[model samples]
Target: MIQLYNVYKTYNNTPALVDISFIIKKGAFVFVTGPSGAGKSTLLKLLYRWENYDRGQVLVNGTNVGKIKFNRLWKLRRKIGVVFQDYKLLQRKTILENVAFVLEIVGADKKTIRFKAWEALKNVGLSHKKDAYPMELSGGEQQRVAIARALVNNPKILLADEPTGNLDPELASEILHLFEQANNEGTTVVFATHSQIILQEGNHAVITLKQGKIVDTRVVV
Candidate 1:
């Protein structure tokens, strides 16, 4: 679960998040939506502690995120998975290796790494392309690989920032389905997207933002 209370963040004295507060319960799927520079990405970064907040509190899974020590960030990050608009895959590494890289960073044994990496790729329906590099795959395939990498560790929370921004509608739908599947399996999902089609197609709770403030929170049917 995630909770934010009066969270305020500013960059160069310019507000990025203003008086933000929300609670995302376990096993919930929520969408964060807004126009460009609306602070959707900034909010996600705060959850993961990738960016520090100037004021207020952010609690993720009962841990005070803002108070965590820098060297201990991996402890917090290991419980969460994040995906970006860009695939962020290593161009030089094979798909399997990219997923396995996460496990390696977590210090998993070699055998476990191989098995989990393979299973993750299979979950994304990309096991057959495990040997391919990022450049060798299509845009959707690359994004699927990115999702596989994000899920390989079986994170408690999944944060996706505009993951469908670059793909066509059909491919975006497929990617969204994968997120839904993860949510069904009990991963709390917070997906940030600006696509109206995506918002209209979902029945999940939505949090709308503008100019760094929350404007609406409701279920889109």
Candidate 2:
């Protein structure tokens, strides 16, 4: 469902991704693994269109991502979900509001928005926290809120960058299990992390980067 062809990206003339190319089929779970500064995060940004490539093409379901118009960017983003280590929830909004806000932007009616938001929160085991503000939650709980917000719209692809970096081992494992469930339910997952624990736990496709180049690609057995 996603393909890149001869992709190149640079920052101030320093290459962040060099001739990167890959194809991720629908319903596949892929791990993007690399050390610090290995360009793993950069690659995800390019795929998500947060960082536009300087050259070549990025195609998602056959549409060129790099060339998407700003007015239509929302169309592209609505099909993808992103989870971050920082748990970028709106600090002042209640958990339900935070997740429902995305649906609101998409113009869904109030009843449907509330239903989907609650369902997503329940999926991440955070339904009870819906009425609480973000500051009142623990780190793991906050991250779960973030995940719910991402999944509320039922995105086709989920991109997570260092999603478990700040949580404890138990919580990290829980988070991974949630991601596994999402993948099993047909959301193509691209998770980028340097966590050795994550590397060891998941048996799936792995794409390893080094110094802005893809050094290894592990096909699922």
Candidate 3:
């Protein structure tokens, strides 16, 4: 679960998020939506502690995120997964290696890492490309690999920031289905997207923002 109370964030005296507040229940899937510069990305960053808010509180799974010591951030991040618009895959590493790197940093044994990494790729339907470098894959394939890497950790929460931004509608829909599958398996999902087609197709709760403030919260029917 995630909660934010009276949260405000500013960058160089400019507001990015103003008086934001909300609660996302455990295992729930929610969409954070807004146009460019509407603070959707900022909000996700706050949840994962990638960026600290200038004021207010953020709690994730009962931990006071703002109060966590920098040295201990791994404890908080270990339970969360993030996928970006740009599939931030390691170019020099094979797709399998890119996913295994996450487990490596988390200190999993080599045997466990190999199994989990392979399973994750298989989940994303990319196991056939396990030995391929990122540059060799298509855009959708690259994004699938990123998703595999993100989920390999079995994270409690998944934060996807405009993850389908670059893809065509067909590819985007495929990517969205992957997120839905993860949500169905019980990982809390907070997907930030600006695509109206995506918003209209889902029945999940949506938090809309504009000019750094929450403008609407509704569950699409």
Q: Which one wins on lDDT?
A: 1
TM-score pick, better of 1 and 2: 1
- Report how far off residue 198 is in candidate 1 (Å): 0.7
Write down the worst ten-residue block by lDDT for model 2: 40-49
lDDT for each candidate structure: 0.96, 0.91, 0.95
Off by over 4 Å in 3: none
Give the per-residue lDDT digits (tens) of candidate 1, residues 106-192.
Answer: 999999999999999999999998999999999999999999999999999999999999999999999999999999999999999
Please give the distance, in angstroms, between residue 216's alpha carbon in candidate 3 and its true position after superposition.
0.6
Better of 1 and 2 by lDDT: 1
Clashing pairs in 3: none
Q: TM-score for all predictions?
A: 0.98, 0.98, 0.98
Instruction: Kindly list the per-residue Cα lDDT of model 3 for residues 140-216, writing each as its tens digit.
Output: 99999999999999999999999999999889999999999999999999999999988877679999999999999
> What's the lDDT for residue 185 in model 3?
99
